[model samples]
Target: MPATDPILPATNGVIRRSGCAADTVAEAGAVSLDVLAARRARSLPPGVRYELKGVAFTLPPVRALPVDLPESAGGDTAELLRLVLGEEMIGRMAAAGFTLGDFELVCEDWRRRNGLADGTAPLLPAAVRPGGSR
Candidate 1:
């Protein structure tokens, strides 16, 4: 938790949120890979497909920690993701250019492949997939 991060600012050695920082942190904390993927997929064309490659995403000081995170989490981001995204979400992943079908496909494929239907993610309800769920 560096003092430089915008979401969790350091003032006198204490961490606190300012302005929309709370909302941003809350949103980031509540985010799930499935829902994020679905939203991204919904915006793409049916025939659209991307390639797979490595990506880099930097988390801010309070990215994985919510302003109202339950105390039981013990300040661990992995635990928070598990609580919101499920145990299958052992960590975080990100992508930019070159992928596959949109992110939704990867999440689905992972689910079906791993049989990780713990029901903690895929926040967006199932809809008529653009490309038949790839």
Candidate 2:
């Protein structure tokens, strides 16, 4: 939540670019998106472009509001694009001097904009956690 964060943007996300897509998953109580562009911007490999047709977002396990619920139970409700790039992508970015926490913040910002819950969990895990039920 820095003022100038590219993902969150101080304008409350009103400056979103065209073509970004988002959706809410009622069962998981989360939101998702096909933010390949955002992922690429996060420093994924050049040839790693893949269409993320549908993905979900939720709060991390440790940060869940109700500790009793599995991390899968849901914590936040935001567009999936806010989640961030996958591990391989982050690895590539890290080699190029990207900080792990920075991209995590990007995902966190996405969550904030989508009205999703907040969690301290890392982005890589949270991004993949919802797929088990798929």
Cα miss at 7, model 2 (Å)? 52
Whole-model lDDT per candidate: 0.38, 0.41
> How do the predictions measure up, each by TM-score?
0.19, 0.26
Backbone clashes in each candidate structure, one number apiece? 3, 4
Which parts of model 1 have CA positions greater than 4 angstroms off? 1-51, 54-95, 98-101, 117-134
lDDT of 2 by residue, 31-88 (tens): 3443644564554222222222132223332232232333433443222322334455
Candidate 2 pairs with clashing backbones: 32-80, 76-116, 76-117, 77-116
lDDT of each residue in 1-134, candidate 1, tens digit only: 65387864454432234441222223523533454455555654333132345532222222223334423344343444345444332233332342334445544543444334644432222243232243
Q: State the displacement of the C-alpha of residue 65, model 2, in Å, after optimal TM-score superposition.
A: 21
Model 1 clash pairs? Answer: 50-99, 51-98, 51-99
